[model samples]
Target: MRSRAIFLAGALVMVALLGGVTANSVAAATKTTVTWKLSSMTAGQNEWLSDLASTNSPGVKTWSKTGSCRFLPEGFKGFLSMGTGKSCTLTLKIAKSGKYPAKTATHTIIRAPSPATTTTVTWKISSLTAGQVKNLSDLAKTNSPGMKTWSKTGSCVLSPKSDPPKLTMGSTGSCTLTLEIAKTSKYSAKTSSKTMILALYGVGDTGPAGGTIFWVDMTRPEGSQYFEAACAGWSDRTCGFDLNEGSRDRLATWGCAGTPITGADGTAIGTGEQNTIDILNGCEDSALAKFADRLVLGGQSDWFVPSKDELSQVWVRREAISGMPGSDENYLSSSELSANLHIGMNVNCYSGCYIHIQKENNGYFRPIRSF
Candidate 1:
């Protein structure tokens, strides 16, 4: 009985010892360890990991570990890698400041052959200056090619992860934007801004004739008069007329020189139509004059042929005018150079030069009204 009791006590002690050893072994196996340190950093700047103190536990193969590094609030790129081995001399660069309120980056380390065992180290990033923030914000607002408007929504920013930032337009409009010029070896940093305006049209002013106010007759008095196209069309010469005396007359002999004539009598809007009609009255077959006399548009019958200068204004503001004939075609002007020929302007060219065409030929016509 004594021997059996002694044996039972020994067995109980052994079991207790074995249980303690097993518990200790399990604790050690589940323990996580990582030996890397990082200090705060500024955006758009580069730094080396070796500058900070780092180490590995004794008998631990840190080089065989795989992990990734990333910044919070997203949009941070180029700071992560997955591989074995401790990269003591690894380099890190943060391109742009991330979204507001948070600027933390996390580095995750996982044990090789068993990713279940892992650890993480977090580091903070310094916020950008007010100027830098503003510059980056402006760069975000820059317009891209084929964009026609400006956008004010969304946080505008440049990512430092990308060496050169890209700009794009968010909406359509003609507006101004400021941009930041990054620092380079050749040039110091600076700010650049530009205003985009429609070529001939001002913002929101449709002209006096109730159409898009494309061009302002700078030479005319304020509200004195402006011209608008009655409609967009080509070749209304069902009835043609002689340009000069015969079928052809030199501009030198015709009384229509020094054109773009405004006022009454063939020069002004209404007078110009009358003047062409009077000159071509006897011909009865005059093409341009007859076309102008029979024209009507915009619920009004006061439409007439524009003078050479007036036609030139249309050319100058063709982009803003909506329906001026294309540059590939030519249109007739009331200014006559000869009996058989009349002065015409190419709708595509804005220089206002005169081209002569036969009076009998059908050409483009965009009748005009004045107010």
Candidate 2:
């Protein structure tokens, strides 16, 4: 009986010691649970937290938890890390500052005042010049009365075009740009606007025709209003010659039958009348020699008629064509005019060479070029 009692007491002591150890282990785990979340984030915001049940684990600057991520304010340069199965509330208060090197200043080139539903966007300088690039942030401030200035938080870029920069966008969308001057002081503080939509995109791979892109040097005017002539004045007769009083076809008494007329007309005529009677005898008369002369658009003097292949490119982008103003017709496609021509010229796309007609007796001339 004495031996049995001693054995029972030994067993009871062992059981008590084991129970105490288990309780202490559970208490240690409970003490490690994290409850705080992150807040007040500016540039490089950082925080550190202990892992559940880790007695002496230090905090990290940035770490991932399953599918979530953590960021630090710019000034706070430390981190808080957690391990698998660990849970922590991350409350963040982000500050608006333009300190991030990755972020960019933005300025937008919009077509109109309330560009809410505008798709065909055109942009021009009201206080600037064509081909001038400005930072998107600057542009936005210039254009809008109330909007937050862009922070150095995202990519912003500028793209200028010699012509009015055009873009297609959702009715309500925004774009960013970086702008610079390319013309004289006379061009400064000048205003320009787009007839279509526009937005700035960061540097990337793209097609030549993907965007309204141009390069400008503020020293002198690189683009001009030369391209924009009164639609009536753009006619062959108005551009290159005056008609003799009698016959339209018979070249006037000028000594050179085919020389383009440089002298101004003595009489004044309405723009509408000029377009109706313009004889295709000047630059348009010769498809090969003078087809590209006397271009007037976007203030450019070097404008020319697009070559056949170039015109074909325009044909493909017909969606972009804002046809001659005050006319019901679009520019003639090779297919559209072939059937209507009183005099048909050669049009062979395969051989890569063909003839085009510009006769005074038949059709009118509509000059065009790419932007």
Candidate 3:
């Protein structure tokens, strides 16, 4: 009976030992370990860590592993992932070196030992540089909370915006004005600008003056008659004036002569001025001379139709006075070529020739006044 009791006690002890061993084996099957091998990363560089693991016993079924990184410093980010083979990798990259001394981050690894059980391991990462810190500070300063702002550089200036500006052309006979743009602290300078031109003119010149200079002579002697004497049958015809008559004779025989007369300037002499005045005075408001008589230019009231010589001078300088040459229009002169014909000049004449149209023929009229 004592031997039987000893066998039973031994069997009970064996059973307890086996139970303890079975408990230890189950604990070992579910146990997992995770570890990180990196402590810091450099700025502007990539860091890779492949030493992370989620190890478990072969008895553990349906296990999964995952890794993640968070709370990284400014300008820094990290990635972590677990592969199908139960291995984990952490990758870190720095986009910019911002203004900061050092940055801190947390890396976490999760291991699922079973469908309903999980274990997590966490650690800290610290890495940053002075230059990166400075950069980050600058970015923050430019983009503050209250109102964000930025800076840029460039310049622009306009002198006359509403009206045309005037410039005096000195003795050099030319004038110029400029429009410019400049560079500011934030902008670069520009090389292109606008330019304006100012035409030149003489002091006593009249009419549309620019590009070239011209003058009209007002050297008529005092007390000269504005018209010739009354004559019949020559209303539309010349009063017998010749082209070669001298200025003195043309002036003395104003009522009877059709002469080519000239002034001291070589083109202002002729009897046409007197003839036009006489015709207009006789006919009152019906004559072309009335058009000249009514003209008031530059505050002068004594304008007259030009003589043949005067018209010639105007034609020669037409470009300077009007910015363009005279058209093919015929202009009347006060001189008479014959008893039935009145003298006229063609502005577009190539050889500066004279013409005789009927006294009543229509022509363009340009009045002149002495300055």
Candidate 4:
């Protein structure tokens, strides 16, 4: 009975020792608690965490080996995405004797600036760009907001070194005016204030007279009225009226009324007879002589019937008369001539003939007389 009791006591002691050992092992494992979180996800980095493990894990059975990853900090999980070739960091809050270690890894990605974009602006030809001429008139045509005023540097010559580049304006924003090249001259288009001419903006009353320096082009119904008689055939009495209505009228009136003085016998008035008839018929009929007997224009009595060269002068100097009264009609007259390529004549009239005034039309005349 004594031996049995002793053996039972020893067994009890052994059971107690084993239980304590098991308890110690469990406490050791639970003491090592770990807290982890992803810090950053750099560019080119994968959205998911590449590596995750408890720092306190032993080599034999690491946190990753168990596949029992714990929860991260409340707000950190949402910001952990990583792009390609980029990186993300993980922050660990480890207890000294707990389940995790304390450490952080940060990764950053690289980026570049975006490519440049192409932009364009409409710029008018200011001056003669290099080897070209600056043609304001031509440019104004066919362009929105036609070319406005030009700068002083703009040039008329085609070989460059003329005017600066410029643009016109209209209802729309800044716009470029198209250029029209002349068929005869190398000039892109006619430019220069030599001739005072301006565009007809809108219809208005026959503007104030004499003060206007420029001319406009307006076609009135009066032109077609006496077209036949005005376009006389053959005789110098009618002058060259067929070539063009306006031209015939101008030359006939100017040349006929502006012819040299003659004696009653139809002979040229040699040196000193008053030749008021020349001025009287200039650009109008005898009745409408504005400058007959030597009228004054620009303070001079030399204003005679423009010769053929003078007519061409009129063409080139068309601008000088722009914007003035009757300019629009004059331009229409030119258009009429251009359409037919007509050539009227201004001949010398020695024989006595009545200088007919364009019945209803008004004209300017300048007579010749020795002062």
Candidate 5:
């Protein structure tokens, strides 16, 4: 009986120890019961706690605070981090009324270097020049390791023809360029647009007739003022001279019976098309004028023989034109000097070709048109 009582007393002591441990276990719970952590964030980044997922641990009391940082949108759980240049600590204290002991979760926001940005996105030059190359890299100053893109939305042909373009302006108008830079680890993302005005066309540019642009009259009346000397093989019979005049077997003449034409004496830049029309109406068989009238090129059919002064302009800029027909110096002008002596001009080549088109080239013709 004495031995059994001793064993019974030891068992009672063990039970008391076990009961105390169970009580302590209920008072001190772990994160396994209620899950949460400090929101993920970057130190130098300007961001809101709204960018993060919220924690609504069921039936658990939550309290949060920060050191040398900010919580935004709301003070209890929302935070905006203007915390730059150093590590920011967000302390979250979570507890339950009768379950877990009060504990704090310290989250250190990670720090990284700031991004590089373009100082200015404006073009260095006042405007774009036709037939000249503009360096796009000069438009901005940045240490970003990524590329800068330049683009425009229109039918104008870029010189290299890429999405973001480098262009030789096709005509005279407005040219707007857009700069786009994608986000990168070392650089911030950015997009900016600027419009530039280019109101003049230079000689020696590609014209509407798929021919060389030799003259641009921005000062003339709007529409159809630029002149393109047609490309080689101007997509027509040379000079329209083979077909006899009207019904008679008469080759092209300044007028019927080589008679002096009455109103075919225009000699200016804007008068070539009209001169060709006048000659055609007067003689009804003028080939030079017919060639200019009937030719179709670059999807345009407005070709014409240049007048005397117009032909001079062509002579001065002949080198800028392509597919110049025959080396002869008897090229006819729509302007006539008299009955049998029609005004004419051609390239005079001595040391090389130079503009002395006070001369002529007859059979193979030089033609021009407006667009």
Candidate 6:
């Protein structure tokens, strides 16, 4: 009741100030309400909305603004925006005229800051093969959570026909994937491209050992690891899930009890196999849990624990493997950083996780052999 009296008194005052003539205008003024939206935005993002300033009054509507943001004309119909660039408060006014006079309401908008960054979108692989199936998330990487798109020139089709689409190489020929991530409020936009060839034995193909090839050291270099994208994937023997389990048993202490082992501490891409061998020879606790060194998968028994970098290679290209770990999964590397701490790789929505973790903490492990 008190609020109604205040509104009626305010409307009468507005009528008196405007020297109104019509009775209907007075009623409309008392019944109308206005709303303001305070939004934070990034400069140059050019994001706009339809209700930055709005009202619920009949008859012809009028709106106005005061700020650095683009107003009125840039806003279509009832739409409004603070516009773009350096921040400032935006004062807005809206009015509704019924019969003889117009009733007005006013409000202010809040401004915010935009952090600057150099955004980049990169392809995980440089080439592909025809009739090969691949996940889009595995093939491209972005620094922002913005839109991703592609424009190509060849026989290629994105499959499952859904958002964050998967890729299936169509028939034959060469095409390009334009890796792009558009700007969001926090980060800038970026784009890059990589050519994918529809040939045979590309990075994501199956190696002679029937494992997904992950690293093809470019020039073959007389003794290259493999000519593809990943190694064989194993899901049965998880690394850090249990203390009375495989990795914690004989594979305990990252090879030696209290000191870093010599050959087992390598953290590079081509060093995992050696690191595994060294661990097997040096640390032999009497337990019958299958470690990476004792694995005999894919018709070969040379499988070893991947080093830090090798584990990363396997992780980044995990989508190409048949049964790789999903999001929020972890893999132990053969690289030991300190007492009971080893390097490992983890998969998540956002990544940067090549750090030293507890050897018997969270996540799993998979062994990969360089054929």
lDDT of each: 0.43, 0.29, 0.38, 0.29, 0.58, 0.60
lDDT per residue as tens, model 5, 130-189: 545554554444455556676775423444345344555535566666777776765677
The sequence of per-residue lDDT tens digits that candidate 2 reaches over residues 164-260 is: 3332222223333323323332222223232212222211211122221122112223332111211223433332222323111111111122343
Q: What is candidate 4's lDDT per residue for 1-371, written digit by digit as tens?
A: 99999999999999999999998888776554443443343333333332433345432321111111222334444223333333323343332334433333222323222232222223322212222333454443422332333432122222222354432223222222323223222122333322111222211112122111111232222221110111111112222233333332222222232232232111121111212333242323333233222434324333223222222323333333222122222211110012112122222222211222322334432112221
RMSD of 4: 26.6
Quote the positional error of residue 155 for candidate 5 in Å: 20
Query: What is the lDDT ranking, best to worst?
Result: 6, 5, 1, 3, 2, 4
Candidate 4: C-alpha lDDT: 0.29
lDDT: worst 10-residue window of model 1: 120-129
Ranking by TM-score: 5, 6, 1, 3, 2, 4
Cα miss at 275, model 1 (Å)?
A: 3.2
Worst 10 residues of 2 by lDDT: 264-273
Of the two candidates 2 and 5, the one with more favorable lDDT, higher being better, is: 5
Cα lDDT of model 6 by residue, 81-101, tens digit: 454545545443334455423
- Per-residue CA lDDT of model 1 for 1-371, tens digit only, reads 99999999999999999999998887665443344565333222233333332322232221211223232224533243333332213332222222212112335343233222121112111112121322223334322222222222222333433334333322333334444444443334444444422123231245433444433342344432445654333223222223232222112122333332232234333345555555455444455555555665334555566666666666666555445534456677776655566677765554656688666666666566555
Backbone clash total for model 4 is 64
Which regions of candidate 2 fall more than 4 Å away from where they truly are? 1-19, 26-34, 38-236, 239-303, 306-327, 332-371
lDDT of 3 by residue, 171-280 (tens): 32222222223434333333222222122223123333111223311223433312112111112222222334411111111222232222311224444456556655
Clashing pairs in model 5, backbone N/Cα/C closer than 3 A:
71-79, 72-78, 72-79, 72-80, 329-360, 329-361, 330-360, 330-361, 331-360, 331-361
Native RMSD of candidate 6 (Å): 17.2
Name the better of 1 and 6 by lDDT.
6
For candidate 6, what is the TM-score?
Answer: 0.41
Number of colliding residue pairs in each model: 29, 73, 30, 64, 10, 7
Q: Each model's TM-score?
A: 0.33, 0.25, 0.30, 0.18, 0.41, 0.41
**Residue 4 in model 4: shift from native, Å?**
99
Query: Once model 4 is optimally superposed onto the true structure by TM-score, how far is the C-alpha of residue 313 displaced, in angstroms?
Result: 1.1
